[model samples]
Target chain A: MRLASKASSPPRRRQSFTEFLGRREVMPFLLLVPVLIFFIIWNTIPTLWLLGLSFYRFSLTSGRPPIFAGFYNFDSILNDSAVWLGLSRTFLFVILAVGIETVLGLLLGLLFWGSQKLPGRRVALTLLFTPMVLTPVASGTFWRLIYDPTFGILGSIFRGLGLPSLNFLGDAHLAFGAVLLVDIWMWTPFMVLMTLAALASVPKAELEAAEIDQLSWWQRLRLVILYHGKFILMLGILLRTIDAFKTMDLIYDMTFGGPGSTTEVIAITLYRRAFEDFTMGWSSALAVILLLISIAFTATFIFVLHSRDRKQASLAEEGA
Target chain B: MTTWRRHLYHLLLWLIALVFFAPVAWIILSSFKTANQILAVPPVWIFRPTLANYVRVLSDPGMVHSFINSIVLSVTSVLIAVAVAFLAAFSFSRFKPPGTNFLMFLLLSIRMLPGSAAILPVYLMYVGFGWKDSYWALILFYAMFSIPFSVWILKGFIDGVSPRFDETGRVNGASWLSIIAKLIFPQVLPGVIAALIFNFIFVWNEFLFDYIIGGPHTTNVPTALSTGLYSGGGVDWTFVSCVTTLYILPPIVIVYVFQRYLLVGMTFGTVRGEV
Candidate 1:
């Protein structure tokens, strides 16, 4: 706080306009103004336009003044059968994808955490995370080939096993599942990285005490690991949820939201409307809906984080 | 029995690791194989590997041009993003503005804004300014996302650095920029490195904006490779793998050589744990 006051302080006698605009206090905001304006024009304006567009009958190509159709778009979207279907499918995908990622990430974190005792743990962790560092476009293409169901790796392996080949990218259910698998494969290690960091910082004495008390491995994990790692786990969920929701490159490349919109997550749908169809106004509305959903999740996550921070603070105070 | 269980656990770990990394491993291995060899049943592991695919990809005029384009555009964007984010993060850390929390929230909210939502109007703006198909178009657009990210991650780092040093610097009659350069920058150098590396990899791999904004002349590596793969035949799996391996090299090499920095870089500074 003293540093902040000192950082914000400046010498007196600034009579010129140049110096006035150049004051330390005003300068940061000045440097920030260009970006702030960019956000207002590029981000905030479109969002407000989208909110307005959601209340109207809209199509980009028509160029007609959007008739204020009074919740018609919302009504239509809500009443549409495919919308609910899409929502349920999206829910299933989010739950399943996040579920797999969390479990796998936890396992991987545990492995790495255990490997801290072993030689060459860093090398092992690096190799494990190579896939996570890959670009989604290339990663999607790599998997697309692997899921070929003809001469692809899995296809060949399945044929050797006397099982019918899985049409990973062709069937609706399979395609959704394929996307989820790709997401998990691509991202689980990220959770591992974060969780491993979180776990490493866990107070070793506490775990030792739990063990001394004859607590089993599971009990130690439940009592110590989760308690220390809660912030990181929440952070992982928050980051992964936002990312999975906005995922575009893979869906765009692998399925093109196809085999008939089965893989059409909201990101794909929003892209189609905004870019392919040129319905900027309506697409903005869809974007707003997505933003609302993300904000809701983020808000909940933040609330949890804040309360946890407060709880940790009070505990520290008590311990003191 | 306990020894057997330990062996089984090790076996399970290796098996899972293999499963997790197989596709990537396949891409690397297949890049060396001929197209026909790529599809060979039982997957010929002992076959003589060839560099013909890499030769072919590199010799392509378009591919060579895009390699340069990707490097220049990504480096420029990351540098600019880091520079601005450094200042913004400094301000955010040192001075509590009137609406500091609101502003910070606003900065993060930009990440959640869909790219498609802004692409069109930004494209229109580009056209108006006659900046289409130029490196500036991509550099500026990418910097838009990178700046917020740099601010978010770097602020977390800077905040973790205690304010006492800056206070001491000011007591010696140091200017703001001097304080930043001497005290804060050195203190948060690792954070800055992390932010730079993240931005570098992200821009290196960015596809959507590059595809839409970059026309034939200004194609980045991913755009060129993906589109070129679909040019005449069905997906040129061999060439695609080759290009991917090449595309994946820089980041891999970077993180490999600078593994410590990259690992420390990925931390959001929340793990400092009171020291």
Candidate 2:
């Protein structure tokens, strides 16, 4: 009598363990393993090493290896006046740059929002985005030339106006403001791009209804434009804020943390600590603090994005 | 809007565009000016344009070497990143292994970390391994840093591909790897190209790591320009302008040609879902 064939043939016996590893179910893990390993080696390990280094007293220039210094590195950084100053200055810079960029970007975005019918909008946009695409280092270099006290264009303009030529990058306050201006110039277009995308998605019917109702400008903004654009606008702000915090290449090229330490932001301070001072352990401590601040910003961004998404989902469900 | 008001609005928009374009135009124009003309008070708008600065910069072997280095580093890093990211993204889009969300979050967080924070340990590690100024060091760092972005973007693109296509391939006895390589990849080729271009532009413009880890042997254009400017006592405005012009050419051209993709790439994930 023919034995009833197993409903599914008994699981095929693998010739070797390697054949089992080649199964379809394991394919994803196999493909992902290499990338995961890379991330662990490059990103995870370095981060942990940085954390470990923070607790040690290691100087590259010193003959001795790293000595475990307990909390000394952390304690010194916490009490250091320079570190505090850098933090505050960075905060101020982020505020000024991101604030101005948001306003300017929104205005431009609104201008071009439904104005696709308008002449030269495409060309105008391309021109506006030119600055955003340029290498930040190159932008910094060009701006440095522009802000040159003697022969720079701004200087010539000042002279033309019968005013004393200002030292744009020389004076302590001016240097900070100058860097802020460059940051705004380079990034405002980014704001405009994101804002424009958001604005494009604004329900045209609502806009027409507001127009028919003769709603005030503020009312139209509140009920039509902003209602739709808030999520993307906030996203743009969050991204810009994080990036503004990471502003080092521009500062490195533009001010080198300044005529003194006037323009020294946290990144610059960290750089000096690690490279200039060769205080490996201390700089690593600063790096850890900087990483914490970045994580905090990123976490807030993700939190806000998720809540917005959920809110949108619930609103859709309510509409349904 | 009234005709006059509309006209005025158009004028204002044009003015804004002009303000943004002025600096870029000035840099390009200055590249053609002599040093005296570059520094001329009441700025020289009309002058006999010269290619002297361009010739001078091109003639410099060191500048040419850095330019080549920038090209090599950026292209190599982008290719490696795209290849690795495509495989991982294919896996993510297809199989979506357990804890994919956690892994992705981890990757993004690392990408978001300040380069300075990561660069410190990386710098030390490089020194310890005697990898300073090595092409592999820069290429590997750039490729690794870019993988998260590439994976995110490429996975989004792959997700857009129809699952039925993969199923059909598998029905025809195509292995997973063969299906991805033959069917899905060709369909997502545009996205792959976009990712490649984005990574290229990013690595090309990168400065901090190039500044710290890179030295004379491996100096890229940005590092070279910055260092030259920082160290040179008397600034040669014309020469600097020429170098800046040359430095920005490739990115500007790429952005102009691939404006749509470049815009999405530059904005990360913010504009993609909305538009």
Candidate 3:
């Protein structure tokens, strides 16, 4: 009943000032207003502006008024080989990077979870999680140095082992993997951070109850830990996917989509399109497409999560 | 679950962490070495250290200015974001307003919006208003960008705190502001701090907007690092090593101080709680 009722709240307007202040809704509404105003300015307006620009032929660098072009920008962008190439590459990168990070993160998080009694766990965790928060510019800059073919550490290590130093960033084939490696280095810890949270949020009482009921360890993990951790874990995955799709900072800093455009993803393409090329209308069209894709992703995730919550609530009601 | 297995896990964790930390450690170590020693074959595992690099980088006006800008911009934005988001989070958690789900979805959608998509209009808007190279352009945008996350994290934390505290505060004839300030604020301070650090890192690391809208007046650290300073012919690894070494310290230091609240912080709180 409580779960059912939380789904709906009627909008209240025209209340006396004191009466409004006295109500519970007033607190949330009042508290949220300042932030709502901020986001309206910073987020919504720009997004809408971009959408408007998508339908017009415009360029900031060009000294001319925006000519309204009906679907011309969108049509041209769809036919652009570079744009499609960027999108496909970005998708592949997101899949591989997020996949590896999730697996590695879960493995490491499990290790940490089981190592609760282990010595120096805090220090290890702090050290490991540092990369996630490190500025991409710094990480990229440092990694670039380390990846330097002739005079860098990796190069020296190679030479010491009687091997020729490889030009990782300059090699077309190697550049993508090198960039992906740095991504894994930076983001895998984020997965570990979230995994720890997810695993921690697994209700202790539920696990104990499952054990007492003679459930196998596997069953306990599945029915308890996975059940509770799925939302956080899914959220982590979703956030990473979105972020990885937008990744350009690391690539820009490290490779600049170089060695023959091998590492150029959607973000790089967008950057070059809007910033360098200054094709405002066409780039805005691409941006609109990308935004729609992102929105579709988040909307689907929310829909699934909502349905799962409802099903679980009903299941709980039955059990209760 | 066994003792020996736990020991093995710990050992494995140590090894992986070392591998993960190796690049940063090597660079920081290299920062103290002479330029020749830094690029030495066999990597000069053991070397006499010096502060020459630090001295050189610190003396550079551009590097110092960018560092100061990075610190000021990040701290200010994250602080504002936390202060606003905290109240909003408190509201979201406590009041459970109608359309909370839709409201939250709208919030997260904003978070999910990529920077590249909006850079066109934002850059143009800034240019038109003569806000180019202004601190407000960055500070306000970063603050806005940080809000959804701060709220999400803070709301999750506030959820963990019992509403009984509010009830208790109210019974003592405390006003909402007093209860929120004196009662709730202390309870969620760790969460607030965690949010601040995270958003601070986000703003600090962000360079695209800084590159576009910020020019001579507001050159942040990333843009400073990017502009052929560390690249192209005649590169200066010594200066870069110093800058990189310095850049790495802030996040690690923040983590060290906020280590206690990290688990609570990193947990992607219940953005799904409206259900």
Quick one: best DockQ, which candidate? 2
After superposing the true interface residues, what Cα RMSD does each candidate give?
3.3, 1.9, 3.9
The digit string of per-residue lDDT tens for model 3 on A204-315 reads: 7987899899998788768888898887788778878888887888898888888788999888888888889898888889888988887777787677667756866897
Q: What TM-scores result for chain A when each predicted structure is judged separately against the true chain A?
A: 0.86, 0.92, 0.84
Per-model TM-score, in order, reads: 0.89, 0.94, 0.89
Real contacts retained, model 1: 0.29
Q: What tens-digit string does per-residue lDDT give for candidate 1 at A1-320?
A: 99999878885754997666657678668656656655665556545656766676666579686677776666666676765666576677778877788888887788766553343445555566777678788988888888887777888888889998988898877888888889888888777776776687689899889979999989888889898877777776776776676678876788888888888876677677667887655555566666777667756655765777788899899999
Off by over 4 Å in 3: A1-28, A202-228, A304-320, B1-9, B161-173, B228-232, B271-275
Candidate 2 chain A, which ten residues in sequence have the lowest lDDT sum?
Answer: A1-10
Report lDDT per candidate. Answer: 0.75, 0.84, 0.81
For model 2, name the residue pairs that clash.
none
**Candidate 2 residue lDDT tens string, A1-320:** 23556645687775686555546788889888768877877788777888899999999999789999999999999999999999999999999999999999988878866565558766776777788778888888889879998878999998999999988898887999999988888899889888887787688899899999999999988888899878878888998998899888888788899969999999889988899989999999999888888778878877877787798789899999
Residue-by-residue lDDT tens digits, candidate 1, B1-275: 37777666666666666677778889999999999998887667778999999999989888889889999989998898888778878777777667766776766666664455446556545654777788776787788777776887788788878989878976787767787888889888878887898788888988878887778877988887667767775888888899899999887777665565554544434333311
Measured by TM-score, the strongest candidate is 2
Q: What's the residue-level lDDT of B102 in candidate 2?
A: 73
